[model samples]
Target: MTRRNRSGSIGFIVDDLNPMLRGWFNYFKHAYRTEYREIDGFIRRRLRAILLRHNKRKGLGITLDAHCQWTNAYFAELGLFTMHEARVLACRPR
Candidate 1:
């Protein structure tokens, strides 16, 4: 499906990197270990939960290559992942 993104570009600053690594690493750890396995629901439900606290203007999907890289850096600065990445990760095949 087509996803929406916010206008303008996003960037990263040095101060926010640590928290971003912590948060994303925490998320990756839980996800890799199948922490959400017992929860019976749509992927969107879990995806939404993961992304609910993040910025919504960055679009979603694997097609977002450069955008995703910029977003990762930007959110890393902001100490969060772009909501779009959550959607992409959720939609990704196991």
Candidate 2:
């Protein structure tokens, strides 16, 4: 989803990504020791990179600034699926 020339809103990308993430999470939910946090972080980092590129900026300072601006909560608001949440829900007793 981090294609350099990809055009469209972040919402569009998240909409396309959600289903794939859900399917993958369902299939792998049985793995009790999976590092969902790391997976979520990786996804978020790629998303951050996309945002950075979209804004045509670079450098560690801008990257850190972006992190503060576009936080995980911001992505959640955009409906980006998170593996960490999936893990929590999957582990909950019904």
TM, every model: 0.22, 0.85
lDDT of 2 by residue, 1-94 (tens): 5564467778888888889888878887878436778888888887887788778787553366788989999999998898888787867899
Give each model's clash number. Answer: 1, 0
The collision pairs in model 2 are: none
Off by over 4 Å in 1: 1-72
Clashing pairs in 1: 6-57
| Model 2, residue 69: C-alpha shift (Å) | 0.9
- The models' CA-based lDDT, in order, is 0.38, 0.79
Cα miss at 76, model 2 (Å)? 0.7
